[model samples]
Target: MKALVKTEPGPGHVELVDIPEPACRPDIGVKIEVKYTGICGTDLHVLHDTFKNYPPVTLGHEFSGVVVEVGSEVRRVKSGDRVAVNPSTAVVCGTCEYCLQGYYMFCPIRRGMGHGVNGAFTKYVAVREDQVYKLPDHVTLEEAALAEPLACAVQAIEELTDLHAGDVVLLSGPGPIGMLCLQLLAAKGCRVIVAGTSQDRLRLDMALRLGASLAVDVTAEDLQQIVLRETGGIGVDAAVECAGAGPSVLACLNAVKRLGRHIQVGIIGKEVTLPFDTILYKQLQVVGTLAHSQKTWVRVIKLLNQQKLPLTDTITHKLPLSRWQEAFDLCERKQGLKVFLSYDE
Candidate 1:
């Protein structure tokens, strides 16, 4: 089995090597044949050694595939069933305080699929049966691969913020997560303003096509002034920071109105000084969420099924596992939104 292994934390350390294929642990979990896997921003960070994790681990969390073999206790799925893998917390003790409250990610012993254990970047992945979800018959494997990041965006916007209809939403980024947030907020009937640098024009255009009220070039527009003027000298009702850049985070904070909600979805690699006074003086509600919950996945899939959001455009590049390097380069160059690696022959 060919799997991209991270030998060490440096440029070009990732290599495609023929490794032993994962075996089905029927007593413990199910083995899946990965059909398609999407490379996420986190995967890039992991490759760059910026986001530290277990060494020598497989490098993918967003993937979709077919059930090859099921564990003994896994009765919900069988061989040949299409599925999407949700690489979130696994083996949560239901009795724990966080687990009891349904905050699985907060569980002290929570183990994620890709970060803590082997992920879907290989020919086969053995995951807990509970973490697998059936992909809709109408959905393609490529679309199923998006469930992870889209679920994150859904959780960031729907669960973390208190947004009202007709309220303005200022999204400061045009990456996949940011574009997804733009679509989700527009579906909620909010006026969405997507702000990004000139380099992000392609993604911003896609956001506008999805439903954003306006797409402002960060270099050309006074984003804060535009938001304030559009909101009748007030400001946007909510601001979502989806770019993991210090300036984007600052812009989001500045665009949000007084007493407004701000959701920080981006993961800035390092600490940086921020304007705490604005938050305090305006009585702003600043919040942050790590990853998606199971409940959020359900809602995000539902939104996809309803045809209210079109995610296919975000998938601009598709390549085979052999071209993994090119895929990484494309993502790093910001040439596309989501790049899917086809693991199936």
Candidate 2:
């Protein structure tokens, strides 16, 4: 099988190499013939050596596949089942406090797919039964590849805060995750203002098409003034920072209503200066969210099954696995959204 492997520790050591097909563990795992895999921001971090990753391993997490073989104990799925996988928190100590509480991502020894172990950027991948969710017939394999990221947005919206209808939301960043957040918030009846820089013109336009009340180019316009005008001189009821940029975080802090909430979904690799006084005076609640949970995945799947999310609009490009570099370049250059690497027919 051909797999995109990060062969060693460094800035650029990734390669497409032939490797042995993974065997399904009869007790708990299933072997999947990968269909499509999405190139994510974390994958870029891995390529740049910014995120923690296991070398000599495959480098994709957001993927969908068909079950070619399943272990005897894997009753949840069987051969020919089409599925989307939750790459993180797949393997964990079931007895740990976090795992016992259904917060397996917090388990002290959790081993995630892609980073901690071999992932789905290949012809075949062996995954634990618990990590796989069978896809509905209505959802295409390309859409299933989006479920993992959608689940992350679900976690941020459904788990991180108590949002109500008609609430104003300022979403920073018009990337794939941010666009998903906009759709979810809109479905919940919240009026969303999507913010991005001039470089994100296409994405900003897509956000408006996906129900964002307004799309602001922060570089070209005053975000604070727009927030004030949009909210009748007050501020947004809640703000979500999804750009992973320092300026975006600051804008969220400044534009949110006093005592409102700020949800951090984007992974900012380094430390940044924040306005401590603003947070203290405003009594704003700031929270950080990581990957999705089982509960989140359930909601995400439901949304996809119901055809409620506008996922197709966000998928701007799709290339074969052999053109992995081209896919990565499209994402890094911000020329496209939700780029997919097709592995099989």
Candidate 3:
């Protein structure tokens, strides 16, 4: 089996290596023949050595595949079943308070797949059976590959604030997660304003096509002015910062209404300075969210099954495993929105 292995620390240490195929552990794990795996922002972090990742490991966490073998204890899926994987929590200490309450990501000893262990960037991967979700018959494998990211978006929305119909939302970044947030908020009847810089022109345009009420170019136009005008002198009910940039965070702080919620969904690699006085004066509710929960995955699958998400356009490029460099380059250059690596080729 050929896998994209992060063989060492430091930048760009990844390579395509011929690795032994993973064997299913009876009564615990299942072997999947991976079909499509999406390259994510986190993968880029891994390449740059900014994110925590184990070396000599496969490098993809978002993927969909067909089950080739199932452990004896895995009755949820069987051989030949199509499935999407939830890779956030591969191992957890059940005795931890967070784990006991079903918040496995909060468990101190938790080790996520693709980072803490091997992932699905190969022809085959052996994952714990509990991490697999059987895809519906109507969902294509390509669409299912988006489940992991969509579930993260779902968690962001559900855990952030109580969004009501007709509420105004200011979404920053317009990147993959930001775009997904735009679609999810729009579907809930929120009038969303998607904001980004000049580099995100195409993504901002896509946000409008996907149902954002407005798209603001933060570099050229005043985002605060647009929010005020759109909200009739009031600020947006909630703001989601997904760009992971300092300026974007400041913009969200300025655009959100008094007593409104501000959700930080992006992963900022370094510490950022924020306006503490504004948060205090406005009595703002600030929340920081992590990865998706099991419940979020269930909701994401339902949304996909219902054909509610505009997902086809999100996937702009697909390349073979051999062309992984090209795929990574496209993503890093912002030339495409959700670049997928197909193993079937």
lDDT string, candidate 3, 312-339, tens digits? 7788888998999999998887888898
RMSD in angstroms, candidate 3?
1.2
Q: Give the TM-score of candidate 3.
A: 0.97
lDDT of 1 by residue, 52-103 (tens): 6576777888999999898787887888988887787655776788777767
Model 2 Cα lDDT, one tens digit per residue, 1-345: 789999999898998998899888989898999988888898888899999887987999999989999888889898999998888875688998878877778989887878779988888999888888898898988889999889889899888899989999999999999988888899899999999999898888889999998999988999999999999999999999999999899999999999999999998899999878998999999989987776888888888799977788888998988899988998987899889887743
TM of each candidate vs. truth: 0.95, 0.97, 0.97
lDDT of 1 at 296: 85
- List lDDT for all candidates, in order: 0.82, 0.89, 0.88
Residue 256 shift from truth in candidate 3, angstroms: 0.9
The backbone clash count of each candidate, in order, is 0, 0, 0
How far residue 75's Cα lies from its native spot in candidate 2, in Å, is 1.5
Residue 123's lDDT in candidate 2: 89
On the 0 to 100 scale, the lDDT of residue 100 in model 3 is 72
Q: What ranges in model 3 sit over 4 Å off?
A: none
Sort every candidate by lDDT, greatest first: 2, 3, 1
